[model samples]
Target: MPAGTPDILACLKGRFIGIEVKKPKGGIVSPLQKLKIKQIQNAGGIAFVANSLEVVKRELSEHNLI
Candidate 1:
């Protein structure tokens, strides 16, 4: 994986999804990670930082992937 690759990568309904999982407490997103997330989004992919399963589910639902 690349230096800032997201923790989970998936293709749902043909849409690229990148998820960066952080601990619910005190988990920080590094600058590199942030940059990668932005890059993915800019390239028309779905990318986000998630602190919990609920967040991940919500994001997917918002994108109509679930």
Candidate 2:
């Protein structure tokens, strides 16, 4: 994977998805990670940082992917 690549990458309903997984506690998103997320979003992909399965589900649902 390239620098700052998201932890999970997938294609759901034809949409590109990128998810960065972190611990529920003491998890931080670095500047590079933030930049990558933004880049993915700017390129019309769904990208975010998730600390739990609920967050991942919510994000996917928000994008109508679930």
Candidate 3:
């Protein structure tokens, strides 16, 4: 995650990407966060909740952003 925020930003060959890292156990996504991610997606950007390296890779790959 980035400083003072729950999100980390990245770029995959110029495409914007945002990651929200969460715990692996019983983690929940808040409504506000969901709205934010939805905005990213609406803008053709990628957004995900990654709890591990594997999850990060999966999300990127799933979005064809990696």
Candidate 4:
């Protein structure tokens, strides 16, 4: 598997989704992480770093990905 890949990968509402899980506090995204997320987005996919379940819900809802 590729390094820095998201923890969760799935198709939601006909869209490719990637979600990287992190700590609720003091979570840091490395440069590699930024690159990986950008790669997914560059391919017209949905990707996000979520520190909590609520954040995941918000991202999906806000983007209408679900």
Candidate 5:
């Protein structure tokens, strides 16, 4: 397993997806989490920080994975 992995992981249409979920208003992303997200993006994957289903959906939509 990769260290500092995001809360959610999946692959859609040959693209990697990583999502870090938090409370709608109070969740904080740690440094390690940021690094993980960056790593995923740098590797040509999609990464997002989401606090709700809506946020996740939006990110997916932006990536055309939904």
Candidate 6:
């Protein structure tokens, strides 16, 4: 868990995935979030920063991780 951050966790296919959701504008991922994403990847998981539900779907489809 990171300070002042929401639950940046998303799971798919029995794997741990970290997701930092943001708005369509001026959305920025914090440093702690970046670290968390890296940690998730380092732990053999997927991580992403998405702007919208469509963006999430797009990422999942693009990566074939859906």
Candidate with best lDDT:
1
Show how many residue pairs clash in every candidate, following the order shown.
Answer: 0, 0, 0, 0, 0, 0
Best by TM-score: 1
Candidate 5 global lDDT? 0.90
lDDT of 6 by residue, 1-66 (tens): 546233566667777766788888998788887887787778888778888899778867766777
C-alpha TM-score for every candidate? 0.97, 0.96, 0.80, 0.89, 0.91, 0.75
lDDT of 3 at 25: 86
**Candidate 5 error regions (>4 Å):** 1-3
Per-residue alpha-carbon lDDT of candidate 3 for residues 1-66, written as tens digits (9 for 90 to 100): 423233788788788888877888877778777777778888998887788899988887887766
lDDT of 5 by residue, 1-66 (tens): 666799889999999999998998889899999999999999999998999899988888988888
Worst 10 residues of 3 by lDDT: 1-10
Model 4 TM-score, 2 decimals? 0.89
lDDT of each: 0.96, 0.95, 0.77, 0.90, 0.90, 0.74
Cα RMSD (angstroms) for every candidate in the order listed: 0.5, 0.6, 2.9, 1.1, 1.2, 2.2
Question: What is the full ranking by TM-score, best candidate first?
Answer: 1, 2, 5, 4, 3, 6
Candidate 2 runs further than 4 Å off: none
User: Model 4: per-residue lDDT, tens digit, 1-66?
Assistant: 688898899998789998989999999988888888899999999899999999999989988865
| Candidate 4 lDDT trough over 10 residues, lowest sum | 57-66
The deviation in Å at residue 13 for candidate 3 is 0.5
For candidate 6, what is the total of clashing residue pairs?
0
TM-score of model number 6 = 0.75
User: For model 2, how does the per-residue alpha-carbon lDDT over 1-66 read when each residue is reduced to its tens digit?
Assistant: 998999999998999999999999999999999999999999999999999999998998988878
Candidate 5 local Cα displacement, residue 9, angstroms: 0.7
Query: Model 1, poorest ten-residue lDDT window?
Result: 57-66
Q: What stretches of model 4 exceed 4 Å from their correct place? A: none
Backbone clashes, candidate 4: 0
